[model samples]
Target: MSASPKYSVELIDGPSRVQFTSASSILRPDGYHPAGAPHLISSATAEVYGNPKATKTIRIGNGGLGPTGALRQLCLAFLGERPDLRIDWVVNHSRHTQVALQAGSIDVALTYEREEEQAAETEGWSRTMGILCHDHFIIAGPRQDPAGLRGLHGSVGRANDVEVSKVKPLSTVAFANIARSQSTFHSRGDGSATMHRELGIWDSAGVPPREQGWYKVIAGTPLAALQRAAADVAYLLIDRATFLYAHHIGAVRDVEVFVEGGSELMNTTCILVRTEERRGAVLEFVEWLQGTEAQAIIERFGKNWELGVPLVTPVSQLEVAPHGKRS
Candidate 1:
């Protein structure tokens, strides 16, 4: 009898039509025939080539535990936009999202801020999709109330004597105290844009280091910073989502949300599709992300009380609740 043909399809781009054969024994049981080429895509090139027409495999680059990763998962499940889509996820610090997307290593990416997209354009790449979710930067520290930020704020009955004493210059006092007390201050790495933003406030307020010993720097992701704070019982700046998730993982324990209510404290996240060709696909996925179905999944997927839905706030007007204030 003649052999039944099991035809294989090979996908390639550009004029290099060279073909090579793979060893028969190496074929995957799942039928994934390994290609005999580099078979790697840079994020920048992917942006130019566009996303695959019909969902096949999507290379998704994610930064970290914050909203970026959460948003991607929501797009996958509730949106049902790419049901069969296989996502190759690369998780790392938040800053890598743009680099991976631009390198063509990923087809789509979730990130924060618009500046990353601008950089993509300078390199001849287009960011086809966007979403603005309200995120907040918060202060997490040991539950012991060390610097007595909690004590300073005080309770309703006693009132925050320290806070009340510095009413006219509350922001200044807060920054100065954190700057002066090493025990009260720590941050996640020097390159972190968010950390830089906070430092800027200290500069503007003329809050000099209370003493060289009063400040410390912890280098890592939100989760790492959270862990450092938990271990040393020190204060560190972190995003709300990470703080919540870190607590659930037990990476950090006995922590509390001590700070809120500031212009610099408000944070936001966004999505960026690598190329113009895949704009439709990216938008479809983004819409699904914001859809009620996806939001529900997001609500459940995050760590116990640690994960939160992206902020659905208009950029023009943003506000956060005060420490003792309730909305």
Candidate 2:
């Protein structure tokens, strides 16, 4: 499952180095079972691959989360539990989940962008099969939260408690305040889903980071950016899981989640399947993901994630309703 080599970011998996024009890059690891390899599909696996003793492949993809070891942990656990299905898991740009699914480069995609999920289903090429988790963001900053962003909740989950018409989400307001205060702020600047969402927040705040001396873009993954922000005592919006992972690993010691949760801060992940293939089988796997076993794995998996912190909320356990609006 290779894409055209016009990428803006480098896809590094072990020894392979591939680039593409799309912000999303594909990481096809070396020595993995080749696509279309013959394997004996089992009963449970047949629900996804179909038929025993047949050659079939299912390509699963996510945004650049593979480097975090979160997606890899989930994929390995799924394969370990099933043992009957062969998967060539993929990592691409999160912002391009819909494009990859539409291009048929990946059979299924775990996407954080709710708009993309709705668009693909509306276009009739894809269907959202399950809600994996609602991973929200954290306004990572110094201990004091000099920007005064603490306790600022977005419109999500606050309608019943606050004035529904007057509240603006923190995703927008926080960034604007960060800019107005001229406090330091770091950005990944990479094409990953995190970067896209950060940009969207800034845009919603009506203050793009363009030419701002205070806004700095660190070159690396989300973990790397957050670490750099810690060193600089700058504020940056980061995914909660990644921040917790960094904390658990002891890599980022200074920054913490000052503010989080809201419709705008919700990075709700959905398991999407291309409807053109064995949709029923993929749907079966999706069902398992939302099941207890997979949900447990999700709750437990994460390299830098701190245990008992609930970095990522399983769909079954989230306070917000599945397939429901956050704000």
Candidate 3:
């Protein structure tokens, strides 16, 4: 425990959702190891795409991830909080977090969303789930709106004041409004998790931007794309954490969060371990991540970022995570 909670994190259930992970594996086609190949296990002081390492440590598959060092900071904080447990985190973006942990080449892994469902779907792998934290989506665009994107939905994107008052998911409506007005919208088109969610919201709104002239797919990392969106004065879906990083760097001063809050905008990351592996260290870290101590670290994380808003919201339980819980 930090013993002095600077910022309070909304307490949620620990590491619950298991969305598709948003990182990449660094192994080559035939066999290429970062540290001259492996001897045993499945990772190292690095992440394991599939290469076997030589340590039995709990290999959390997140590091130096996101724009503002959120996950990497979390890893550092965890180590600070619990010195007894040593974690070798490799920044992983491939689907192998599940495969390595499932195949017993590793102990546990932390990855993005719906992991519980996907874990269940995978025939023979046994895994237990916990809610780690949430990095939510913020619909951002130019401060000057072309589609009345902000005023039409108000602060939180609820369609209460318009003729389309019947309402759809406000997030969906936000995108639909962009299309209805043919407002320029940027798509990563790289099929990243953020991109996947953006497209899903469009589908949910029944207005896919398949061939619309207003829809333009942009290329680059999330930060680069965000900078592009700001330059073009276009609208795009961006993760709050990355947005915080971009904001810190002054990459998106012209953009503002138009639609946020509500579960539809949530992007969850979960901590997973084979229930059978049952490593005391893994279990301790997972439980502690959701406990008061680690949550305090997550709570005060953004104070370091120098941003007024916590990049990621604590929602599942401040008891699933409530960034909306300002203490």
**Model 3, span 20-78: residue lDDT tens:** 22111212121112333221222334532222342434666542143466665565666
Superposed on all Cα atoms, the candidates' RMSDs to the truth, in angstroms, are 14.3, 10.3, 12.3
Estimate every model's Cα lDDT from 0 to 1.
0.50, 0.62, 0.60
Best by lDDT: 2
Kindly indicate the candidate among 1 and 3 with the higher lDDT.
3
Which scores higher on TM-score, 2 or 3?
Answer: 2
User: Which numbered prediction scores highest in TM-score against the true structure?
Assistant: 2
Lowest-sum lDDT 10-residue window in model 2: 38-47
Per-residue lDDT tens digits of candidate 2, residues 15-109? 55444333222322112224333211111111222223435456677754455566656665665645456555665556455556655656778
Candidate 1: residue 68 Cα off by (Å): 9.8
Worst 10 residues of 1 by lDDT: 24-33
- TM-scores, all candidates, are 0.64, 0.69, 0.68
Q: After superposition, how far is residue 119 of candidate 3 from its true place, in Å?
A: 4.5
lDDT tens per residue, model 1, 127-213: 645554556677667777665555445222111223323432333444545554435567664344466555655554465442456
Each prediction's number of clashing residue pairs = 15, 7, 32
Show model 2 residue runs off by greater than 4 Å.
1-57, 81-84, 150-166, 279-281, 299-307, 319-327
